[model samples]
Target: MSFLDKAKDFIDKHDEQVDQALEKVGAEVDKRTGHKYTTHIDKGVDEAQKRTGEGDTRP
Candidate 1:
C-alpha cells in the first residue's frame, strides 16, 4: 500500500473529522497572520483537500 492509498483510506473513513481538522488548521493560520493572508491560506487548504481527493464540495 502506497502512502497515497493509505491516506485515501483514512480519508474515506474519517471524512468529517478530517474536514474539521482542515478548518481548524486554516483558522489557526489565519489567526496567526491576523487575517492578512486569508486568501492564500484558503487556497492552500483547498489545494490540500483536492490533492487528498476530497475536493472542496463540502458545505
Candidate 2:
C-alpha cells in the first residue's frame, strides 16, 4: 500500500482510540479547572469526534 493508504488505515484503526483519548483529556481538564467555566465537556468531545470522524452514531 502507498503512504496515503497506510495513513488512512492507521486513522481508521485508531479513530476510536483518539476519541477515547480526547474524552479522557477533556475530563481531566474539566476536573482540574472545574466545569463551571461554561465549557460543555460532552459537546467538546462530540465535536472533536465528529471533526475526526471518530464518533460512532449508534443508538
The top-ranked prediction according to lDDT is 1
| Per-residue accuracy of model 2 over 1-59 as CA lDDT, tens digit each | 99989876776778877777777888888888777642687778778777664554323
Q: For every candidate structure, what is the RMSD over all alpha carbons to the true structure, in angstroms?
A: 2.1, 3.5
Please provide, for model 1 over 1-59, each residue's C-alpha lDDT reduced to its tens digit, 9 standing for 90 to 100. Answer: 99989988998777667777887899999999999999999998877766553555458
Model 2, residue 1: C-alpha shift (Å): 13
Show how many residue pairs clash in every candidate, following the order shown. Answer: 0, 0
For model 2, the local distance difference test gives 0.72
Clashing pairs for model 2 are: none
Q: In angstroms, how far off is 20's CA in candidate 2?
A: 0.6
Determine which window of 10 residues in candidate 1 has minimal summed lDDT.
49-58
Q: How well does candidate 1 score on lDDT at residue 16?
A: 64
Per-residue error for 51 in candidate 1, Å, reads 2.2
